[model samples]
Target: MSDPELATRLGAMIRDVPGYPQPGVVFKDITPLLADHDGFTAVVQALADAGRDDAGRPVVDKVVGMEARGFILAAPVALALGAGFVPVRKAGKLPRETHAVGYALEYGEATLEIHQDAIAPGERVLVVDDVLATGGTLAATRQLVAACGGTVVAAAVLMELAFLPGREAAGDLPLTALLVVDGA
Candidate 1:
């Protein structure tokens, strides 16, 4: 389906919660969409399509998903694309050698780590996350991928908090999101 149409449908499935985890934070909850098989399928398909390889094959060697929400979507996209799934998680979560990168968030600084062997040299990777808020998490994920000698093919998300400067911080990377919120 076209981006706009797909976005409309996906947007309909998202629930908005005010003051979640903090005051003045309007959280865009995605549980409703995750529970709907068709809605989830459409979202995963769209993300997988966005991360397609150049030869039209599932070119990504690894699908790198961020902590928490990212894993939900990335694993399915990895399976659909026939690629291996990797997770960039918080510190002390993985029981293996890891490489970490720090980035700035709205409130403070945060760090993300990926297994050192997650990606080998020249491996193509696609990073997936549920929401792109401040770009800090995604940017750090990109750096972690590079540290593992992986080439980031693209970064895809279910939604983008466009009010934040995530796109600009993401630089020239191929960033694709199913839905974008202008002010949320």
Candidate 2:
């Protein structure tokens, strides 16, 4: 059950900017869609649906949003699913004791951190992000959740760059992407 019109609308709003932050990289900018009331609402609802079961019951105890863009989508999703929101931040951004994981990006290596007490033992987690590219961030986030004794049930993204090997990097973790772009 997918909405064609919504897909069309959302797809149109995503602008492709060539060579952003680095050469040979086309950034999928989602600002236009976020600025629109209806589009934003629809996208949030769509992403939140990933945290539910087939019978429409919320199945996650926490919704984890990665650094920067992920925070924008995951906060509302957490509210929609009636779950707690946890932030997987960049190194040193968090004040308290945290568990850290270093990951390789397309350009360089980076580390992410989460508070030691962010999630109670055995909490179910759903990771949300703006885009799925190399999948390094998602993998590192998964490790962070595991350190907190939480399990990542699935992941949701607004867009997926199919040219990259993100799906493989995710391994067996379920991933739902609203729009799939075949190329960079």
Candidate 3:
């Protein structure tokens, strides 16, 4: 579970669209929460907080965000944490030499890419995303970070689908979500 107050404030704004992109799936849309200035700010700040150490230092050198929606929250989180933002894009979206990882999605397999030089060796990283579903995306991002020699210090997500076993999928990685759905 995430922060109860934060979840209460932001969860209600998430709209439900049944059978979106496929059947039998209830998509949780968060555009409404993003539109609310205060809500958005709170969410971003709370996510950035996850990048800090116990001594209140920004221990992360980079914030890695997955493709598409993940980019939205991650860029802001990187800025808030005083770290650089790196994008794990899909397929050929990147323009330079990159490292790629293929992971299993619920329906099939997909690939994600990151720049080879995105993170230096020994640099600490924080992965951010809007949602944590099956954890395939975050796991792929973690592999990319390892390939780049960067350490994934933690992962921060706006919402988590708890029922989906995403936590188990992420293994030992530290995860902090702002909202959690039991049905997820």
Candidate 4:
């Protein structure tokens, strides 16, 4: 299916839960979509397509996924693109020599780290995540990629909280979201 069509179907499968994890915060829960085989495949394929390199071969040398949720989709994307997969985790999660980047979130400040040898200089990278809230995580991930001498080719997410300043925080990088929530 086309990206738009797949995105529309995927969006329909997501459930919205009001006052989740906190009062006044309506969470866009994707469990329903993730549980469906077809939906999950479509979502992953859309993300992979979004980050595809223009060259005859896959352009990205690596795909960097944020800790936890990012792993679910990123691994498949990396395989689809024929690129290596790297994990950007919270501090102390990686045991190897690492490079770290710090950033502030809506709730608190945090640090993310990637292995020093995850990507070589001038390698192309694509960062993947489930959602773009404040963009802190992704911005920090981008910085981590740069510190490792890798170039961020693009960022793709399943959902985007448009009310947040995520796009502004991401700067000039390519950001694509399958579904956008106006006030989430």
Number of the top-ranking candidate, with TM-score as the measure? 2
lDDT of 4 by residue, 2-78 (tens): 76787688778988898886787777788898899988988887788766756546768899899878998899989
lDDT of each: 0.89, 0.92, 0.90, 0.87
Candidate 2 runs further than 4 Å off: 1-3
Candidate 4 lDDT: 0.87
Report the lDDT tens digits of candidate 1 across residue range 1-184.
7889999998899999988868888888899999999889999998998678556678788899998999999999999999999988888899999999989875568889998998999999999999988899988998999998889988899999999988888899999989999976
**TM-score of every model?**
0.95, 0.97, 0.96, 0.92
Candidate 4 error regions (>4 Å)? 54-57
Candidate that beats the other on lDDT, 3 or 4, i.e. the better one: 3
Clashes of each: 0, 0, 0, 0
The local distance difference test score of model 2 is: 0.92
- Which scores better on lDDT, 2 or 4? 2
lDDT of 3 by residue, 144-184 (tens): 99999999989999889898878898898899988888973
Tell me model 1's lDDT, rounded to 2 decimals.
0.89
Which prediction has more favorable TM-score, 2 or 4? 2
Q: Report the C-alpha displacement of residue 107, candidate 4, in angstroms.
A: 2.5
Which pairs clash (backbone N, Cα, C closer than 3 Å) in model 4? none
Best by lDDT: 2
